[model samples]
Target chain A: MSQDSQPRKNSRFHLTVFALIAMLTAVLSVGTPAPAQAEDGTFKLGLVTFLSGGAAGPFGVPARNAAELVIEAINKGTLPAPYNSIGIAGQAIEPIIIDEAGGGTKQVGEYRNLIQRKNVDAVIGYISSGDCMAIAPVVEELETLTVFFDCGTPRIFEDNKYKYLFRTGPTSTMDNVAAARYVLDINPDLKSVSGINQNYSFGKDSWADFKGSIQTLKPSVEFKTEQFPKIYAGQYGAEVSSLMLEKAEVIHSSFWGGDMEGLVLQGAARGLFDDFTGVFTCGETGMFRLADQIAEGTILGARGPFGVYAPKSPLNDWLRKNFMARYGTPPTYPAYKMAQALMGLKAAADKAAATAGKKPTQDEIIAAFTGLEFEGPGGTVKMALGNGHQAVQDMYYGQYSNKNGKPTMTNVKRYPADCVNPPDGVTSTEWIKNGLKQASCK
Target chain B: MLKTDNTSRNLCIAFVLLLLVGLILPNWLAFLTTIALAKAMVVVGLVMLMRAGLVSFGQGLYYCLGGYTVGIAGQHLGITDAVGILFVSAFIAGCLAALLGLLLCRYREIFFAMLTLAFSMILYGVLVKTSELGSTDGFNVAKVTLLGWQPSPGQLSLVVYSLACLVAFLTAFFMHRYYQSGMGFAGEAVRENEIRVEYLGVSPQRVVFIKYVLAAMLAAVGGSITAMIAGHVDPEMAYWTTSGEFVFVALLGGTGHVVAAFIGAFLFEVIRTIAFDLAPYTWQMILGTTLLLVIFFLPKGLWSLLKAKKVGGNNV
Candidate 1:
């Protein structure tokens, strides 16, 4: 090559490389905010939920929809009763929605991004128990006020104490306790009970809690079989056969999301539900999608008094009406949990502002949230456990029945929070084993 | 003399550029880059295996082992020092690879791939059932310390980022040299014709076993750093999809150059973040389309673009 040509080519290559670097730097700068600017009086909130993947269908999508509708209602000052205000403490709510489909580690990084890069004043969302556990410490380390909406693992608070993190819904133990109670209350001749749960923390803990509660409630109720299938295992042929072989009079499952739907479909196809009265702890989330497949007389629990079992009140009526009108279906348990979390945040923020005469800081908001009581769609949610870091709420369970070709719960029984939830300082296992003597059921 | 001088100068230039990035980039970008670079270490290991005509569909087994080692060491064993945890994790991963390599080197192609995948799935199953380690909920990794000095939360990110840069540069430098070594060439020879390598008085299986062990160590480093940065570890690290991602990045960057893995991981992260932001509902579709386009236009991978330009070729 000629010398002059070589120099010209080198210059062109240098220009191209420089341009590429400049372009990448510019693109990256888009995700990074330009430092913390003066607050514009808007309450920036980061709302995370699964937007894609298996969990999104039953849990994440409904939660996202509820956040959208509720935020819009709050900003417009159209919510009924205590929530009838323009945003929290008169500040407009600006939400930045993030997908939580990624694993726990990714969720931790996203949580940091929400606080450090996006400058969200408060953050709420996590349906995966793993994500909640992973994020709890990081939230405390970052000193960011955060609320875990629907992850049911009790270990988040049981294992570690967090100053700025709270779960706005009851733990998984409550659902299991109420499920066992409902079964024993109705089935006087109940003898053998079998269980099929996803082989995960939530499922294992729930099964253990249910078995402990049942063993305490009836000593002669023989345990037949227990199967822990992998989470999101799309088929249940073998699991169904095992349940049939065991001849369990009642089968208990804490499956949720697509896994629950898959089990219902496959079990019904095999006539597994015919001989066994299946009791599902998280059946409400999939009821709308699996209406036809859910056999009549199959018991269902909402994890709380949510969806069809929601209390009769104007606030709940408005939530149900607005959510149904927008999403073309009534809000389910996941949506109710999301709504409850946001409503609790609103109450805390409003009270803190009123007390301080200004928008409260993260610590101030957390202080107000501790022992905070608010009326949720499901009824009253009290931060009555975990040193007020955890919520204890009443739960409902009922049998599924087809009413006018749509699935609805019949003979629903609402168990008081004090009846199901373990008392302060007592683990669910210990409480159940001790026959719940310390529990206040009134 | 000139070739050695050029290598030194390039290394200096790259180090300076990374230092500048660490200084200038925002915290979130720095965090993302650190993670991508850490993950690139594993992709580089995959590329090494690919050079030997071996594809591990279960590299996550080593990766997850590394992460869980760091976690369990810190949480249960009271080993909170970053360097100590990383060392223990790498040692554990290397030992496992050494034992597994004996049997694994006996197979090739699909059998090797399936065996690796099966191993990772076994780890996943074990982790899912082990409730003491938080079961599927997984456990949080405690804050890391350097020697006896513990950085506060604000300073932790910067410290981790700097460490990631230093580790990545050193690994890449050694890897570049290893590519031209006798054992490295023997790997390619075994890949091309195992009988010919055996006839050359070099045991092909031995070379493969050494490469497998080395890859496991590199992947462990990647996993350890990732756990430190994220401050959490779960069975998902050992899931088949995570290993698939490593393979994707390795192929995306090509096994031609050592630096390609870093570039590929960086580009992947940037593309994925932007896609998720722009189309949260269809980000996976966008990612798939990008991969398809890359395969259609630049089948040799993204690194081939730089190589083709350097050679002034019309390969595209």
Candidate 2:
């Protein structure tokens, strides 16, 4: 080898790496330009959801799956109402997808790249409540329309009233309040209530909101011994031992994914559920992943604006089978919620194209989406412009029961969006200052 | 400057050109490069420790400690000045290390590593249980108080990047000086032969412990810088895995030279991005393979490999 030729080789390598980087940057820049090109059929709907990682995306994964199934079903002309033969205006809605399965600063940048550079018409994403709370402001500034599926952090919507943002799933306030009401419904005289939850905003807020509702609803039930465990981390043996020792009649937890599954398995192993009634705030996976170890008699609450296994409706069944067929799993509510976000965009586009007599503008889509409630497999769901771009939707509670050796929500009941959620006119900042609002679903 | 490998120094100049490419590279690259710089800070400190006969698995403890202190001090104590916070963080780690070093100074070899690890685990346990501090969820920092003027309103990215350059410059400056000092000589000697170092009238335990404290302080500065840039810090920063990452970066850079840390940092940032794009799900596999290859073939680190090629030798 000629040593004199080496500088040229290094230069060539560096040049190639530079050129490749240049090409990538050019591709990335023009790739997903928001509002740059409004060409019909060219518009991409970026549906970001967690397809991997921790139990962070249990609801979001299902929501994304359901969204995919709905898109598939709608593409096939198999959905109900204005959804049949649903081609948005004259242009068909196309999905450009990315997975935001993990949360952190890195993942947020990834979302920005998808929304800003991928040139998505909308973003329906995020399962982790913390990530959603962090990203809300950025998306608001960018105005890349996003419809969140199952990030239940109340702080997300309480602050900004972001124009381009909308939430479809229930809030943490709704989920916990509904859980408390459901428990009291079963036994009115239930006394001591203990909560063991993941120590993030969702878990802590679940206990706080549930306690607030319980204080107002079942005046006699004293909430005590609240346990906050780090989410998706460590064995819950010590936390569970403390709870078991408490002998509280009603135990509520917001642990989900592996943490939920692990705790339930351990509690069952330890006979922690021998006589006590237990409620899980997010036990809504339809037994796809967590069914094996979830102790019997424990009720799970869902942010179920899209009903979880609502009826034998052919479309729901088709969606279920379709998702199972495609993904080797039954459709969870998150999948449907994700589908709703997409369908909502396509529906808006179609409506705008009809009313404007042309392709939908950003304003037209915005107008169409405002107070625009559409009926789907799980009844009508609407998004009113709430504070910080939060969804005002129903949260449901159900007892997990075996249906043919599968976990399904039984005794489900709806707690409306405005119930326990901040008032319709309230802003996120004010809600934070006022703490959470308390209301009965009735 | 005198201790640095020339080829790596040129690669840095080349990276400066690559950074120019970033001007046109889009926000994604800028975002990623920022993270790499942040991680590199901690990695540099690890290299320093490794040179001194110390392999710290508790660097994360200092990182988390520095990060949380900056966040809390900025948000609560009104210490919004970014430079001041860094100083405060470094000072805090220095003090904590000095106190802990007194006890740790008498310990030898594996016991020192374990004791530092124990300190980190204690921090993790305490932080996890303390919900008001956001504990395991971590404190979401809104802004770094830059003196009385906070920089979040305008030029958030630029302000952070500027502070980053200053920190990098400072880290390189101080760490370079550290490696050239009599302490540096003792550290190398201590790593090579502790009994000999003991015979030379410097207790190996004391040298290693002092090195441990200094490394902890450096790691703390890095952590504070990252927390300010990212706007979040959690107990995860204190996890042993975080410590392990620094060690990996040191190994990747060959740990023999100060500039290798910078080279390792750049490669890590670039490769990690490439990995994320290519496999998104299985990036760890690529990371593992790269590490194995670097460890097995280029035992002197990437810089040493480049230097060997300059000799016109056949061996790679």
Candidate 3:
């Protein structure tokens, strides 16, 4: 308040302004990209997944583990026959792994950083449908080869086409469609059905596809109560109680990770699983982790022929052996999906490079990847949908049964990719509503 | 008059320097800078309330509203003009704030904070359930033309980055003037003692309401720009955590000067980016620890560290 302090306050105010400018300059200077890392005979790939948050343990970490295992194998030429070549296109593999815990907006920024800053040759990541949708357009804009390992929303392709984007896993539509078909084949006496899925795109799409397929498959089936609790709502006491009250003959959920574990635990405790035929479209994620808690007769799928239901193949054998040896847990569906994506990329790159007799250009890689078919640990994966940009693989379903002390799946069935997935150029919604007339089943 | 001129000249010089910086930034840094500036705009509005001793925990209501407005406009109504969308976003947010401000302005302190948060959460809940808008995943935002001049995909980042800097400059320039104006002084008086403000024939309630609505409009502008740059909008934007971030930046920068909001936001983003790269699993812990250190060492904020000396040892 005194004149002497007045001048000092004025000087301090200016000093504060100067300090702010200096700090900003310092930060921006750090962001100024260093000369892009020289291409040191290695393919720098960005692998993104939920490294933290609720999805980390069950989904993201497994996917990350698979990437590390698969990339190392690819780099060392240790994978099976078709993928025995070292690294991608003869270049040693280098991965820049990033966590995809933040929401879509943050993912968008991170995706740009991966491509523009890290200079990744290709990006394989995104388990959240929201993040996938957000990054898809940016992928095209950046014109970098990026593969979405697992995000079940069909809208990504059905909404817009991307030249640089490829999803190496079947959409949630197949998981639901396969579930409906498997349940009907196992139990033709199905009557009323209900669902309790997370209130998000993946959950909503799964339930819709399942319901539509069920209606088309058996018009006599009655619809019952449906509960969509918020995503990651760890406590499902109220939702379980509602499902119990409905007393629907069949219960379906596409919940994954902690949400799936919580729902199964709470529902089993309340005897809902005992009374209802519980079907988890993405249950393969919990097959081993929640083995003791899951009751018998619960039909579950690995989204495709993955994990316990993976078709007998050399690739599957290699992945299972190596993943189990490294992580102490069997590779789940997320792990399978990650392996499939990396293999698909490597296969395409190898093909392109072989034809060119050198490192392939991005366009050459795209040409080889589009509509290409390759064998994965799960089964033969065909880029048969989304104009050959999206993978359509055979789906497997089985009953959860505990034998002795270990949990396992029984009565496993495989639905051919074409039989379960919509044919190219057809949306899953339209394909299901029209009774899957174009479907070719043997 | 001389002091005001000096401040205006300094703002202009700073603005030009930022514009120059935007031009040279790489694509990734441009995107990050765009996001930080967009968030800084929202913090500017929060600082306005902070000056009046009112903390709004739900500024995200307007922020999300602005984002959805622009998204809906582009995806639904076919409006893609960047400038036009910004105005429409601000107007829509202002209208909503005007209606809500009537009831919200009456409350003070924690009640005011919680009420704002409740409104934002309500928007988040509604957006999550609206299947037409893509539900919880929300939907993508299309690229826009700048005054009918469309930039190529490669050039869009720089264009939007420059625009963000420009907008921030204008917001800071006007807000600095407002801070020195009668109404601005009235806000401080209300914070210091409401009775004195009322004794001066200024209705404290009316002043608070005006500040509330203006703050909402500012937040909406921030949200709209973010949606444009990120090309995506979701219910998460309205979630309490997003609002908490704006508050965190406000406290970090201090309400000492208009530029503090931006300085704080930039530092927060930089720290987060580095921490994430260094310790991907424990970045949140690093962020929390940084805030703790800031509050402990410089209670007034990072801005106070620049001050010549500590007087009276007042922490808040």
Model 3 chain B lDDT-worst window of ten? B307-316
Worst 10 residues of 2 chain A by lDDT: A427-436
**Which candidate has the top score in lDDT?**
3
- For TM-score, the strongest prediction is 3
**Compared with the true structure, what per-residue lDDT tens digits does model 3 show for residues A231-308?**
888999888888888889889999888788888889888888978989988787887777888889898878888888
- The better candidate by lDDT, 1 or 3, is 3
Q: Report the C-alpha lDDT of model 1 over A1-442, residue by residue, as the tens digit.
A: 3344554555555664686587587655766675544277788899989998878988999999999999999899999988887888888899888888779877777787788777888999999999998888888778888999999888787777778898998999999988988999889779999999989888899899999998888989999999998887888888899999999999999998778888998999988886789998988877878888898899988888888888899989998999989989989889999999999999999999889998777678889999999999888999988789899998888999986897778888878899999887787767888897766656
lDDT of 2 by residue, A64-96 (tens): 667666766566666665767655555555765
Which stretches of model 1 miss by more than 4 angstroms? Answer: A1-23, A34-38, A403-407, B1-5, B16-25, B313-316
TM-score of each: 0.94, 0.84, 0.95
In model 3, which runs have C-alpha deviations exceeding 4 angstroms?
Answer: A1-36, B1-3, B309-316
Model 3 reaches what TM-score against the true structure?
0.95
Give the per-prediction TM-score of chain B.
0.96, 0.87, 0.96
lDDT of 2 by residue, B3-100 (tens): 56554365456545644554554555555566667677888777777777677778888988988888789767877778888888999999998888
Q: Judged by TM-score relative to the true structure, which candidate is superior, 2 or 3? A: 3
